[model samples]
Target: MRRRGMTRRSLVASAAGLVAAMGTGGDAAAARTARSVRGGAGGESVRNGGDESVRGGGGGEDRFARGEMRGVWVASVANLDWPSRPGLTAAAQRAELIAHLDRAVGLRLNAVVLQVRPTADALWPSPYEPWADCLTGVQGKDPGWDPLATAVREAHDRGLELHAWFNPYRVANHTDPARLAASHPARLHPEWVLPYGGKLYYNPGLPEVRRFVQDAMLDAVRRYAIDAVHWDDYFYPYPVAGQVFEDDAAYARYGSGFPDRAAWRRDNVDRLVREMGERIRETRQGVRFGISPFAVWRNAATDPLGSDTRAGVETYDDLHADTRKWVKEGWIDYICPQIYWHIGQSAADYAKVLAWWNATVRGTGVCLYVGEALYKAGDPAQPAAWQDPAELSRHLTLARDHEEAAGHVFFSAKHVAADRIGAMARVVADHYQDRARAPR
Candidate 1:
């Protein structure tokens, strides 16, 4: 999701307002509470169990009752969270990153999912792709320091897990290939790129493109000590009105045996997930792989196994990501569904979606960490529920009712720091009373 145009000053002001709303003794009390929660919540140890197939149904042991996956996404795309904006000095950028890590530690959070490869570009020196434009405002120009490497080291030192987030197919926000760095893989191999819905994406249907993207992402896995490799819900771009993905050629070439184009597309994504999981294991054991997909898989009206929601987009039908299937098949280590809604909304109730996911991963050993919309907490355009400071905290309380709910990861770091309307602060007061370790 795109970030709101809230300024840093405004975010700080809102955080102050939150403190006032909390009626705390002041910053000192808050700091004390944060420190107190740093202790681990005792329970079963959940670690990466390799690629073992996790099977069963809703009735099974809750393996992650005490563990948690508290994380915040440090988005680099469009400079939503980190770097403040493009073109900052390398020292300034490093300071900004350190501030974010410090903020996580103060909040008693245990993980930071930093977007190292925002748009098929590298935050580190990758032989496969150019430097990310978000680093220096010049796609191919090095920012003079290694962001992924520094992030991993600093995070581990702070006792926070650093998950390297990557967007596999997105090439650029714009459609102009000439605007990209000359060394950009998308520009060099034009046939592998597709301009769709005003953005450029590497064609997922091509075998070579799939393999190349994996190699590019794995380059970081091979270099850094990142706790996990995370992907957002951008597998196939969300459907645009009246526009088509225009993968006719790739489909025709590789879609021979599949019954239809939709099935073929799903298979393409499945291969990417399954193959990436295998390759990640081959590259580094104990390095987890996870996807934070759009909440709804399918509406019950669409399928019997689907959630009881009327979401506009279904990951199965629109994005072609069989997220539920991935969990059942044990292709990935964990599943964080972006249930970005309120407790009792009409379309996709946060509780309902959480319950659906809780059931989906019950018997499967895949951990369930709810993806929260902290960005929506005080968004004026959001429903009234989000305006209430207690909305997000209520979500955590509701999630506590579910046996399979391991933890939660907020949308982007800005909102967590923003604490707009004090929602995030309220969440900490209500639910994050105890510091928890990230589930394996």
Candidate 2:
């Protein structure tokens, strides 16, 4: 088969690796995806990053997880992807969103993890918090319609599962309570929020804050037919240099029983994850509750069971997100760790991270999906390896070797649409040669 846009270097290396088709654009992307899904449009063979006979490579018959959770994140904060910018008419907003879902389906992906709660605010009309600034550029002003409801309808129509992504404790990207809506939960209960790293966050250590955020998010879950309730790697937020999270007042008030502050913080986040899981199951029996945590749980230097990498941050240590424990205990239905690194990365090898995560969820019933960094590919700020169109594809190639690596979710939607340097094209040709089912 012709390489199409594939660069010769990657094809020689064995090579590497859109839309809810709504209109013309959608039709084209969907056509490409349909061709791959329907037995590779005549069972065309693909040469993948030096592996000629691997899954979905030759005869396109060995594709994994036809039902796997293939997904992409549609970030709303700061106008990263949709609406192009904030304050678009409700009609325009809906169109942009449908376009994203169409893009996902066009790429043969079955899921879209859109950020409904970008910064402790709602993309939809919610009683818990005001409409997100990401939608109207004004915290409280409603856009006259619910984005989440529209998203569910459009996504389902395109045969894509919609995962409502929430940031449990984040209040705002800035550290000002007065600027918030008058009835905003954070403003009303300033004591429940903590200013850290120039940002405002609902104090995870506060019991009231935890329950309130859960309720706020669950309100949306109960109202929508979303396939999953998703949380990103922001449980306690990454640490800031020369600054400490001033939860001492909270710790003193509620953490007297724990042996230390770290344990108490871990317990706080643990409750959020555990209780959220239980509530999601109770509210919607099959609505999968999942988390896409920071890739590194803990460095092996600190814990032998940790991955063999020297990431500057650890979800368990700094962010207080016990990602591993959640998997072992089955507190989450799936763990989509953001292993956004290239293969052979010195600080965090994509191959090693995947293997570590594979072992992390081995027998736990929790599904495993590595969060790929499509956004990193070809970005000048990224390491030199990311400049290669095949780097991201190589990561997927490596993942095929791991039994527990169920699937992958790309970082964001725009990168896939860009197909920078043909990185995404390489992947479509290699692994996603056929349509697959998204895991529940």
Candidate 3:
């Protein structure tokens, strides 16, 4: 893929409307968040950092209920939901973040899974790679402030846990390296990347590649006040239509005693997860580690222990992410499967997967937080289960039904902003109205 050239004016025009909708830019709340910073402990505050005075009636009633790991993903690629556009000014960017936090606090969300390294870049000051293109027009141009630092401080003032979400293997959303800045990791170390599925990714099969990615992400955990090291579902890129992953070279070089390539890839990810978990726990004893894997582990026909779904792509067979293994072995602190499908859909049924995950994670000492499909909550084009106003609420109901299922995190932040299904409003009014103390 060739690099697409863009001018700053074009980016400004593209994002102007988005910036306007982010409200009057800043308010007294924004000023409070700004003033909340005070360089004290663990880079910032612990999770669910909210006001101590505003006590409501609902939180205590739900104390017997499983405490949720509520959060929303703040995606930066293509400027999906944050920074408005590619070249937002640093002030505008900070304002946008404040608005996001305000929404998070308003909805009574316990955490914010902000994307720190969406691709092989940084949202804050970093010595390893350049600034994210999503922050400024130019990739390496400094945004004049540390977004991670400010976010940590402000989020803590409001008492929200900030999990620095990292895309472990994703290098770029596009396939062009020349488009990236000269200092971009892909440009600096071209051999470490492999272009596939219309995007570039660090080859998960290589030992050095695995170590490099782990170290780069762990560097953030070590340096910042990140409450957790969170990873999304980009393990071995979700299968391309007809193309095969181009990792034969690494497999040939490193697959020396493994049974096959599949096992080797699983080993590579497993190694990354285990080592990263151990490293984070060692560096920050309170930092939690979690993974949001694709919903189904495997079909029951494929494996007797797997969920009863007909999904074409299973986490184990296709992505090589043995998520069940992670839960069973107690490697992850929590497991959030993206149960995006409806109740009775045959492809990947939500109820079946939830039951399976709930049963599997009951006593493993790993918390289970179902990843609700907020985007599908009330879409008329979707199945009847989705169109129901209580669709997501029903999922939350299912979460409540489970022994180990604690809480949920919506897919993207923008969805919660829409008030679709009225689920966010419902949770706040009914369950999370008061500030429940943080989990011990």
List candidate 3 segments past 4 Å from native.
Answer: 1-66, 437-440
Clashes of each: 2, 19, 6
TM-scores, all models, native as reference: 0.86, 0.86, 0.85
* Residue-wise C-alpha lDDT for candidate 1, range 216-325, written one tens digit per residue: 99999888777789999999898999888989999989999999999999999999999998998788766878999999999999999999999999999999999999
lDDT of 1 at 368: 79
Runs with alpha carbons beyond 4 Å of true place in candidate 1: 1-66
List the candidate 2 regions with Cα displacement exceeding 4 Å: 1-66
Q: Best candidate per lDDT, number? A: 1
Candidate 3 lDDT by residue in tens digits, 1-440: 00013232332333344334446652322221121111113434464544432222332343332234667888877787788797777899999899998998877776888898888888887777788889887888898999998888888878888878888888888899998889887788888889988999988887888888887887788788877778888899899898889888898899989999999999988988888877876777667788988898899989999988888899898999999988766677777889998777877778888999988875354667778788776777878777776667666665655656667788788778887778667656665656543322
Give lDDT per model, in order: 0.81, 0.77, 0.74
Clashing residue pairs in candidate 1 (N, C-alpha, C atoms within 3 angstroms): 46-440, 47-440
